[model samples]
Target: MQIYKVGGAVRDRLLERPISEVDWVVVGASAEELLAQGFRPVGADFPVFLHPKTGEEYALARTERKSGRGYGGFTFHASPEVTLEEDLLRRDLTINAMAEDAGGRLIDPCQGQRDLQEKWLRHVSPAFAEDPLRVLRVARFAARYAPLGFRIAPETLALMRQLAESGELQALTAERSWKEISRALMEPRPDVFIRTLHDCGALRELLPEVDALFGVPQPAAHHPEIDTGEHVLAVLRQCAEHAQPLAVRWACLLHDLGKGMTPAEEWPRHIAHERKGLKPIRAVNTRCKAPRDCQELALLVGEYHSHGHRALELRPSTLLELLQCFDVYRRPQRFEEFIAACEMDARGRLGLEQRDYPQAGYLRGAAAAVRAVTVQPLLERGLEGAALGEALKRERLRALETYKAEALGEPSDPPETPRP
Candidate 1:
């Protein structure tokens, strides 16, 4: 049997990018033969084996035919007769269809190298439309490589648009779609992913909540970009530029969903959109089975991002209420992520990218200021039960008031003591 490294490892190596993992394809070998050689059989639907020593995956070269629909609707054939060219031809993208031999000889039966040099994301065959998930995969690949100047071939883009209009995207499982989305959001140019999907008509099918924002207008005074969709992309770009975590990036993505629902007569004004966004944000979270932290933070940002921007001007009581809502004393990390998302939103506007976001620092300091007030001191003062809770609240409120004064550059005014 001849083993050759295939797919991403070869593609990334050729692009001079760091290779994270290597996949091997064993040609001219049967599953029984590999098992006899101590390769562990691990694939359930197809013939995939684990190396006896390194444990890297080694699958027999195979080809597939569309047997049904969606991502799971496929029939596979793997045998000693399947040629490496046949296997590579079935891949989704040309750049991912190349393989390498043990002697360092390159295999490019699909002209993957030529496509890579041309910075094109071209499909290997027309059969690419057979698998609906390729729409998402192509968008993700665009996100990953767009920073390197890669663009989807017009012909391939037409194929993608056809698949998107085929009504097959709705058949994809929520978990699988979220997997592609989360990965794309973490890429260096994730905005390209959204724009690519929208350009090919897949965004409307898969994420209508986001697509609706495309033509919606925003107040130019605050958002010079005017279009809410453009603002969302800008936020995603800022998140990536800052290297923010997945939770923050996703939050920024969903932060303005409510703006899409605003009345046309209310053009350029979306008052209360923050609270109005909670439903769509929750819908997205529940559909994707997003992690609790991500869901909670997205909801928090959607409901309070405007509040975050107006932080310095809020009443001391309102500021305290905001901190209490986030439970900043208990989950400081979540509050920090909330601040990061808000910062991305504030900086995402046109001509505001490099502008200061003092709200982030102000809110962070507010959280820290309250966190510095402990219940231990109250407990030491012979306080207990409801009285102890009351004392802690008062102390924290007092601390926030002082912080507000400092942030506003005003004289410190001590809060009145609560009667016990």
Candidate 2:
């Protein structure tokens, strides 16, 4: 059997990128022969094995036929007769369809190298439309390679639009859809992913809540971009520019959902939008089956991002409540992510990308000051049970008050006397 390196390993190698994993396509091999040679079977739907020594995946050269719908509706045919060119033809993109032999000779039956050299992301064949998942994959590749001056070929984008209009996207499972979305959000230009999907009409099918924001108006004074959709895209760009984590980027994307629900009569004003956003945030979280951390942070940012923006102006009690809601003492990292999302929102407005966001530092300081209030002191004072809980609350409040006063350069309020 002849084994050849294929897919992303070959593509990234050609682009001089850091290769993370290697996959192999074993042509002229049968399942029985691989099992006899010590490769461990791993694939459930097709013939894929793990190398006994290297543990990397080795899939038999195969061809696929579209049998049903969505991502899983496919029948595979793998045998000793399957050619390397036949296997490559079933791939999604031309760049990803090329392979390399054991001797490092490039195989280019699909003209992938030519497309790569021209900085074009073109489809290998019309079979690209068979799998709905390719729409997300192509958009993700756009996000990854856009920095290198790559653009999707117009014909490929037309196929993506066709897929979006075919009602096939609705059949994608939440888990599969979220996998592509979360990965795309972490790419260097995640905004390009969303924009590409929007251009192809997939955004409305897959993320209608976000799609609704496109034409919504916002106050031009606060959001110089004026369009809620553009503002969200700008926020995503900011998150990518700073290399923010996935949770922060996810929160930033959904933080402004309520703006889309605003009445046109309200025009640029969206009063109480922070509270209004909670429903759509939960809807999106449920639909995407987002991880617990990502969903929790998105909900928090959506419901209270305005509070974060108004950090310096909030009452001491309000600030303390906000900190408690975030469970800052137990999950300080999540609190930091929440603030990062808020900062991105504040900076996303047109002509204000570099403006300072003091709210993040202010909130961090408040969390630190409150966390410094120890239960040990109350325990030393003979406090126990409900009294201890009340004492701890009062202490934390007093600490927050002091911190706020200090941060704002104002006189501190006198601590309240404890009840007997």
Candidate 3:
């Protein structure tokens, strides 16, 4: 009997990350053998156990059958005869198809190490298309390794599109779908999440709202670029590359979604695009089963007209309005994130270098203004209590007024209290 480390744990080991989860494939263990060994038994479809000491999961090496429909409909065979190589061969990707014996001998019959060294993601077997979940998993892997310049196997991508068009992808369970998507969305290039899905045709099947963005026209001046999808990709690239929180980055990626299906009638110099853009996103979010929180975040992005540029003549009420949105954004550094995303969207506009006026000056001025209003001074003067906060607010207002004409917002007023 052999117990081998498998799957993500091996991948994490190679990536030099701490292993949080461990799966031991007990090659010759039956349910009775596992139970005798003090591993807590669990599984109808696959034989699995919890290690008695470490409490880590330990699943038996097994074969499977597509007994039903969708991703979950699998019948497993956990016999003593099934080989470890056979089990590994049936997996989705080469990077995930290696096994490690207890003595730490890694068995990579699939050349996974070569693929990992080349930074390429490839399916383990041609049977990869048997399960629909592999489509989403590949998209996720693209996001995982995009920063490292990895590319999927062209043939693998073609097979994915073939399966997606076959309509098998719809069989994926919501739980698994959400898990893969949330992980991908949290990746360094979530655009890869969307792009790979789109290129392979699963995007329309899973999330038509984003797919509808393809080829949608935008206002000529604001976007000299081709379509809404292209612009969104540019901005999302910036969002993914930035240090903003996941939710804020997601907001930026989805911000302009409203404009895709909505009609635009421009009046010479103004279009009220933000307001016009909101309705479609709201409708699409509600209709497409988008979570309420994601919908609200999307609105937060599309509703803001200011681009974190020029403080030109922003008044107290304008600043207050921005802060109100910040307050509802549900994070400690929401304003910073929002401002970062807004600047990304604005500076990413087509022909940024061809601006009518200097864009950098405008961006710096806008950031200062947004920051001044949303992030009040940490303290006030004259004793403690709520009075300190009042003083800080008063000082911030004064600073804002005094520095209104400056290229940037006012410098932060010092804390009113600091004894030596």
Candidate 4:
């Protein structure tokens, strides 16, 4: 029952990266043998155990056979006879197939170390195409290591393309697909994830809404990038550069869906794209089973990002309506995320990456100004019921008006007299 530190722990250590978790592969070990030694069984489909003291996972060295469809369609065989080399052969990427002995000696049966040094994300074997999930996993790894100049091997990419065209990607469950997408979005080069998927034809199967944006044209004056798809990728890059949170990044990715639906006759001008985008955004959110926060923010950004870009020019009533739409009073943190997404969009255009986006600060100031106006003041003035709601609205509007006036260096409008 020899245990070897394996998979990500070994790969990251070799790359001088911070290891987050350690997994052990136990060779020449049976499930009964592990259970007798105090290891808790955790895997439902395979023989994986948890260490009683360390709580880390220890999966018995096993091999898999494709039995059906999708990623879950696999039969696993784990026993005392499974060899470490055979187990590694079943892994998706060569970089992740290597392991380390208990004495810290490297194990590289698949030439993973050489591939790592050469900055390649190569598949361990032709068996890689058996699991559809590997396509997403490889794209995610590309996003993670793109900063280190790592790229997917051409042959591996060909396999990914074959998988994409094999109708297997459609068999992937929403939860599994979203798990890869959400993790990829958090990586340093999330744009590359989308690009890699697009290159291998997976994006069209998984996210046709986003894939359609590739050839869509936009006004070159406003979007020097011209291509709506490229602009979206640029926005993702900006989100990464600013270290924005997941919700913000997700919103940025879907914010331009309406532009893809624009008529070619309409060309560069998508007059009411914000309204047009809401349908696709909702479809994507539902399909991905996105978190409520992520879905809500994406919907808001998709429907009103143009409003955010036009913050300074909007009337106080429009500004207040936008705030209400975001429920800024109830969820100020989400409002901040919304603002971050808008800023990324504004900076995402070609040659405007460093341009200032005052809209974010302006919207934040508006939220702060309205938050400063309390319903208590109206209640203290003998207001009640429907009248109280009206009075609060009036006060917030006046506050927003004043805030906008101050921001623009203009004379303030006189406050409306309180109704009797």
Arrange candidates by TM-score, descending: 4, 1, 2, 3
By the lDDT metric, which is better: model 1 or model 4?
Answer: 4
Clashing pairs in 1: none
Per-residue alpha-carbon lDDT of candidate 3 for residues 179-225, written as tens digits (9 for 90 to 100) = 78767877788878889999999988887767877877765666667
Ordered by lDDT, highest first, the candidates read 2, 4, 1, 3
Looking at candidate 1, what is the lDDT of residue 367?
A: 90
Clash number for model 4? Answer: 0
How many clashing pairs does model 2 include? Answer: 0
Report residue 298 deviation for candidate 1 (angstroms). Answer: 0.6
User: What are the runs in model 4 whose C-alpha is more than 4 Å off?
Assistant: 410-420
Q: Which window of ten consecutive residues has the lowest lDDT sum in model 3?
A: 411-420
lDDT of 3 at 215: 77
- Residue-level lDDT tens digits of model 4 in 3-42: 9998999999999999999999999988889989999999
RMSD of 1: 4.5
Q: Which model is ahead, 1 or 3, in terms of lDDT?
A: 1
- Model 2, span 131-168: residue lDDT tens: 99999999999999999999999999999999999999
Model 1: CA > 4 A from native: 411-420
- Per-residue lDDT, model 4, residue 78, is 91
Candidate 1 vs. true structure, TM-score:
0.96
Q: Model 2 off-target regions past 4 Å? A: 410-420
